[model samples]
Target chain A: MSPRGRRPAGSPDAREAILAAARTAFARDGYRTSLRGVARGAGVDPALVHHYFRDRAELFAEAVVASAAGTGAVDISERAQAISRLAPEELGEGIVRSFVGLWDGLGGDRFSAVIRAAMSNDESLAPFRDFIVTGILGNIMDKLAPDRPELRGQLIAGQLIGFGVVRWLARLDEVASLDIEEAVALIAPTIQRYATGELPSSAA
Target chain B: MSPRGRRPAGSPDAREAILAAARTAFARDGYRTSLRGVARGAGVDPALVHHYFRDRAELFAEAVVASAAGTGAVDISERAQAISRLAPEELGEGIVRSFVGLWDGLGGDRFSAVIRAAMSNDESLAPFRDFIVTGILGNIMDKLAPDRPELRGQLIAGQLIGFGVVRWLARLDEVASLDIEEAVALIAPTIQRYATGELPSSAA
Candidate 1:
């Protein structure tokens, strides 16, 4: 019923306002912020959210990328370009620093909500995860090693986020709370090993 | 009063039985299953689950380990001993198979409960994640090349679980429904690469 977003059903132009609002709400409040919150933030009625998003989950997927993009975090195509210039170790640091910096600067409140929602249920989380791994992580993967990038990228990608989960999300006493300096010293070497170590001799 | 269980407090042995029942019931019905379910399954009064576990979350930790031990799958210590003997690529499959074997067979119902509980929130999930990373994954790390085993192990551990998550939990279209052999074949190469691949020279 809001005047700013009365886009008719199936109209591409109309959904943009809803998406913008959804992203703002999600980034501000996190992925689990209610649809009503998003609608209110957008200045549109909650009905418009359903009209464009079909559900809260879809809106959440929109919000993660949008927030990532807005925060200037480096998972974007730009990160790949920057990553290309660094050594393997530097690359790992660049990736880690950028993500951690973004999350840190962004205030963990938003991220915690996103992570909690993502980890909330398998079904609720999958779409957002797929978009990241495929759209965002996949792009990073493409840049890791052009020859057999899939496997190698996957390895790097796994660690990139996995460490984040352990340190930031899980907050294990020793590993989670490590100062960035200590964390960098500890994990960077390990990542370096992962980035350039010799292949193990067997596949099975 | 049932002979199946002992006194509430100071009875270390009785707590273990309650834990065993909790694991089975949680696995069978997930969050929906109540303390009553655990108690009933254990053949003891509901008070005991609270007495020993403090609540479902505490019970969950005990249940998780007890169920795994109950299943006799992956025999953590034995697997720890054998890790060094394993070909690194094979490591992923072995871990995956161990997880799937437990979920699909012995603790299928119970592990599902554990997984569902993990989906809830950080407080309930942190210990579970830590146990897996510090316990299950850490055990495997011991088998890795010692130089950077923690990093390498973490990387491998994340990817393997990520793969399993896609294949099993999230059940994404591209990955979830694959035949076991096909899934293994598709995923193993990536796992192998991560377990032991030289880092790409970032084209700086």
Candidate 2:
């Protein structure tokens, strides 16, 4: 059942209040927390939340994107362009440095919360995954390597997801404590190879 | 509070029964699923479940590992030994192949469930993280690169985690459809560089 089902007594600031509450709820308890709880937290009637957002998943997506935009934290388009402009040899390092900067700037708790929210279920995860695929990786592939763009994009996506798990979730000491430059130095070339080098022959 | 507080009526088969039930519950519902439910599913007293396992976290861990062992799916030690025996240059490819084989052999649903359980929360994730660090990556680092063991181990961990997300979680078309040998060809060199190459200078 949709937690935000119908309109209730509305106020001028009701939408904003609900969005703010959503951010807090998602950050604190993840996607499974009900919108009724969010509405109560925002001091709004649950129906008013339905007026602003179509459903829980949309509310979550909008809330995360809004907060990210508010902080100027979701500028993936600009970052994708920057990555694309780098020399072929530097592309991997460039990608690594930019992402490290982005996640570091977001801090662990908020970023992990967002990741956890996205991973909660397929419905919540779809938009985030799409943003990564079509928005970030697809854009980069369009400019960097036009051939086999899908494969290259998946490679990059896998690389970053893996990196994120170790660095953020597992908090492996060496990876966690790495200086940004040192991490880029170690990881960039691997990305670079994926970006520009030939895939090794399976027959070899 | 510890769910498994004390031993209940002991049967020779009780421990295995609890573990089997835990494996089913965790694989079906992940870390968020209740231990009491597992007990009910096992047809054992809830106290009996607590007696056999320390808590939900331990129950989940023992359950996953036991199932892996039962299926001959957790051969990380043997894989580690084989990785160690390889030349440094070959270590990366060897690792990629071994892991891809291991996960592929486990099938998507079970492997993804394990990952989802680990990612559900830090507490639930610790033993799995430790197994990767000490049991898997640490063992490989000891033989592949003795000097920078910690850093090398984290790199390997990150690489594998990223790969798993794409192949299992994201289920990206290209990554999911990749043949094991082809995947090794594409990913091994990146791992190789992490295993043996010099860390890049930030200014470079």
Candidate 3:
């Protein structure tokens, strides 16, 4: 009705502008922010937002994934590359510090919204799994743990995602309120163990 | 109105019967199973179900918490006691095997229902945090990692709870179909690290 977006429907700028606005709104107001508000901010109609994204979850996934790519926030390949550079013994701390940095730095707000949306329900969670879990996390695991990478990768993802949920979404006071460096200091070793450690032998 | 649950409103038997029925229904049909169906199974009016619980989420919390107590599934105190008896080196495998057993045995069905219900929304997740996180996991951490117990306990809980969600609720085929022993074999060391491992030094 209001002449659509500034650019055409299929144009990259229109789509990118909507996503940029979505990223800002979601970061500012979290997963509960409305498409209408995002549309107004992007100077597009609410219908255009729906046209670009199948639903709120898809929009959110695209926005978070794009932000991660653009800023290299929680970018799996980069993290894996950095961790690979460390001595094998140092991988644990390296991984932990990087994870804490991604969630506690400038990208923290956006990543929190992504995590919150991922944990909100099954529909929202599916895209997160497809994009982040099988994509980013899988890539990291494959690079680090050659054996049982899928299982171990999932274990790492569970730990990190659960951490995000507890620390950010549920706002568990102690874990949530931790200083970023303190959290990195506390949680890194556990990540290290999961990343590269021997499982205990069974007592036959 | 059908004799009001074989005693009175405040009777333990009435409450127990209702919980038993709710547990059965939840196990059979999961979170989407209706309160009306639970009442029908319990041989009481739907109103009686309301008398005992504030809503679906509250009933689900009570049922799952009671199930954990009754079956000792995810009962942190019992797990801590069991782990304490093991050699420190064996603690990792010990915790993993026990956790695998609890979630993969017959109790797995009930526990899956609980996890699914817990993830359904915030209202449903509270009692899970209070009972399981604070009560069971906190006890385990106190017995094992006395320093920074809360963070470590939560990290462990996150890993395990996330495992449950991925394996059961989301039914990620590979993770879900894993043999109980195999899962224990793979996940134990990570748990052990969180339970009693050294945090990395933050190089100034």
Candidate 4:
């Protein structure tokens, strides 16, 4: 085996390095990025990258999730746990604050990179969408909503994703320029309602 | 002048054709798309494309706005006018219905194309963002909102844009699968609140 592939598949450091490299690669190249390039960036052999990830889609999903989790900052499970613990009334603000905080910390360029990569094609889009809908939003709604948690979670995800797209990706001036606190205040109630409020009569 | 460039710069049909072709080209090639390609697609000379649009960025912005307006359906200004005429209580539902109707009419692939083009780069992003923030959302807020119309408009835009992104672009299963009425029913109240309700004390 080549020295680059000599690292054990079980090595956490090698795995993490590959993910980090994948994030950078996806950000730079979007959906069309190749596994071989990712391996080169990580200084690992192509075989090692394949051994670590079943395919580019898996790597892209995990990289994006890792990036969303803020890499070395706060673990995603911890963040989800924190959100799950919020009182129903506070859920909106908690969710908004947590997402804004993470996005802000990740910085605009990195956040936009993830969005651009996700927008590139269907293959890339599915995993990213799944992560947002199922992994983050659904996980929260499952814990807190009284009815149709799946739908409710998707609704909340839509709002939050819109906020991120407007503020970070699209960089719409009004919302993008707002103080984070102000933004949270403006958006939280809507989120709170989605989390624990009533739906339209027909919807209910 | 060559036959392609011979069409008077004042011809409305030529301008519309160029805009349509620009939309297709941008959707295919994104931010880096060349004006020459758009001209070719429209069967016009590059100079004529420049005559109608100052540059590529302007072409991108106009194409996206044209797409958002729903090429053959209700003109954007008419839709905005209809929204403007709504009573305050009906604003949220009206806004949601209008957007969903337009998006539904435009179909998923076209909507995704505009989004993907917008997400491609900053040069392409600004004009699209301005249209949503200033042109569509801001125009509606200015007519009806009592205070901080710009901010209120943005908030509403965020929700609507999020709805479109989740439903059309990302195609999240829960939200994407929703019938138009159900999706609107779930989201309209929040938009209405943004349009007319009191914001958080600090925000106000």
Each candidate's iRMS in angstroms?
6.7, 2.3, 3.8, 1.4
Q: CA lDDT of B140 in candidate 1?
A: 65
Q: Write the per-residue lDDT of candidate 4 for residues A104-127, one digit (tens) a residue.
A: 877766677777766788867765
- lDDT by residue (B1-204, candidate 2, tens digit) is 125543346667667777777777766665556778887777677888878664554464467763643453355566676787887878888889988998888776556666776777776666667666765665576555555777777887788878887787767778888899888888887787778766555522
lDDT of 2 at B75: 53
Q: After superposition, how far is residue B58 of candidate 2 from its true place, in Å?
A: 14
DockQ of candidate 3 against the true complex: 0.22
Number of clashes recorded per candidate: 5, 2, 0, 0
User: Which residue ranges in model 4 land beyond 4 Å of their true spot?
Assistant: A1-12, A15-62, A65-74, B1-74
Compare the candidates by lDDT and give the number of the best one: 4
Candidate 3: regions farther than 4 A off: A1-12, A17-90, A106-113, A119-123, A198-204, B1-12, B17-91, B106-113, B120-122, B170-174, B199-204
On TM-score, the leading prediction is 4
TM-score of candidate 1's A chain against the true A chain: 0.58
- Which of candidates 1 and 3 reaches a greater lDDT? 3
For each candidate in turn, give its C-alpha RMSD to the true structure in angstroms: 10.0, 10.2, 10.0, 7.6
- True lDDT of residue A43, candidate 4: 72
Question: At residue B159, what lDDT does model 2 achieve?
Answer: 83
The weakest ten consecutive residues by lDDT in model 3 chain A span A68-77
Give the proportion of true interface contacts each model preserves, from 0 to 1: 0.12, 0.73, 0.34, 0.83
**Model 3 per-residue lDDT tens digits across residues A103-153:** 666444555455445555555556556654544554466455555656656
Kindly provide the TM-score of model 4 when superposed on the true structure, using C-alpha atoms: 0.74
DockQ, cand. 4: 0.57
Q: How well does each candidate superpose onto the true structure, as a TM-score?
A: 0.52, 0.69, 0.61, 0.74
TM-score ranking, high to low: 4, 2, 3, 1
